[model samples]
Target: MNKIKPGDIVVITHNTLPRLGVVLKVHKREDPTKDIARVHLAKHNKAYNFLISDMEKIIDKNT
Candidate 1:
């Protein structure tokens, strides 16, 4: 998997549904699995912290 960074787009499974969001910040820890990311959900207009491992980075096809 690619390393998730701020401004990257990602998808997270919420309540069994996939939600897309932009990464606002990433809090890295000594243990990579413990890393967390603050993502802004445009559809919901809210930001939430989610475990990095729980989210998948969305690659831009145009890039």
Candidate 2:
């Protein structure tokens, strides 16, 4: 998985139905591998916190 950063698009993979969101912020933990990300779901118009491990970054080839 690629490193998740603010503005990067990501998918919440922990749910039964994956939801797409844009990363807003990343909170680093003592263990770098356990970072948490703040993602904003446009559809829901709300922000949620999720473990980086539970999300998959989406790479845009058009970029």
Candidate 3:
């Protein structure tokens, strides 16, 4: 998959209960680095951070 950058919109597709969020940062998906993606999501009504791989970029195909 192409590498995603900050500001990209991502959606969490895992967990028994799924949610959506945005990417605040990007990191290599391996050792040597610790920080993953920082997502701002709205679960029920509150927003929070989420991982990169844990979510998918929401591509606006309507453009």
Better of 2 and 3 by TM-score: 2
For candidate 3, write residues 1-63 as lDDT tens digits.
545577666677768776766666566655623447666675655456555556667753233
- Native-referenced Cα lDDT, model 3: 0.61
Top candidate by TM-score: 2
lDDT of 2 by residue, 1-63 (tens): 576778888889997989999989999999977899999998899999999999988854236
Better of 1 and 3 by TM-score: 1
Residue ranges of candidate 2 with Cα displaced over 4 Å: 60-62
Clashes within 3 Å, all models in order = 0, 0, 0
TM-score of every candidate relative to the true structure: 0.86, 0.86, 0.59
Positional deviation of residue 10's Cα in model 3 after best superposition, in angstroms: 0.8
Q: Higher lDDT: candidate 2 or 3?
A: 2
Which 10 consecutive residues of model 2 have the lowest summed lDDT? Answer: 54-63
- Assess each prediction's global lDDT (C-alpha) against the native: 0.88, 0.87, 0.61
* Model 1 clash number: 0
Ranking by TM-score: 2, 1, 3
lDDT for 4 (candidate 2): 77
